[model samples]
Target: MIVCHCNSISDRDILSAVEWMRAADPQTIITPGKVYHALGKRPECGGCLSLFIGTMEKSDSLGVPAVLQNLRPRRGRFAGK
Candidate 1:
């Protein structure tokens, strides 16, 4: 299924890109821009943004790296505010 008409990006393209990225770097955060770059294309119209995101969500490898997960600092943890 074609997700992005302007960029000629398909669901399969998105999935493949995601898997490749995950394999290359387990700690990498996959994004729409990266997918476009992987496919040698760029988004023209914003119409497909939602659908593009939907397709990306279907990938099993699409998740934050285990080591990098939940590294954010909690609120009010720093002193001298």
Candidate 2:
């Protein structure tokens, strides 16, 4: 199915890109922009942003890298300033 009409990006294309990226660098963060870059295309109208993201999130290989999963900023550290 076509996810981004402007870029001619398909669901499979996105999935393949995601898998390739994950394999290439397990610690890399997967973003829509990165996926677009991996596919050798860029977003045009921005209409497909939501759908593009949804497709990426649905991929089995898509996950926050383990190294980054626990890196969220703690709220209290900066609250006492």
Candidate 3:
């Protein structure tokens, strides 16, 4: 299941990278670029983005951490504290 032909990245590779990253930092946002970096590779033509993203979405570890969820600015108006 090759995801990125240019970088020789496979589905398993992406999953492993995601798992590793999640294990390393539960709060880190998982992205294609970060997965590529984790696998020691980089995107070439950006053609595999759709499939790459698709594969990433399948991973259970790929989700925003609870601590980072619903973090919206409360009203704004903090003029120098």
Clashes of each: 0, 0, 0
* Per-residue lDDT of candidate 2, residues 1-81 (tens digit): 999999899999999999999999998988999999999998899999999999999998898887787575558767534
Evaluate all candidate structures by whole-model CA lDDT and list the values in order: 0.88, 0.91, 0.90
Model 1: lDDT to the true structure: 0.88
* Each prediction's RMSD to truth: 4.1, 3.7, 5.2
State candidate 2's TM-score.
0.86
Q: Which ten residues in a row have the lowest lDDT in candidate 3?
A: 72-81
Model 1 vs. true fold: TM: 0.86
| Tens-digit lDDT track of model 1 for 1-81 | 988988778899999999999999888999999989888998897899999989999999998879987677656756333
What is candidate 3's lDDT per residue for 15-67, written digit by digit as tens?
A: 99999999999999998899999998978999999999999999999989999
- Pairs in clash, predicted candidate 2: none
Off by over 4 Å in 3: 73-81
TM-scores for all candidates?
0.86, 0.86, 0.87
Q: By descending lDDT, how would the candidates be arranged? A: 2, 3, 1
lDDT of 2: 0.91
Q: Output the number of the TM-score-best candidate.
A: 3
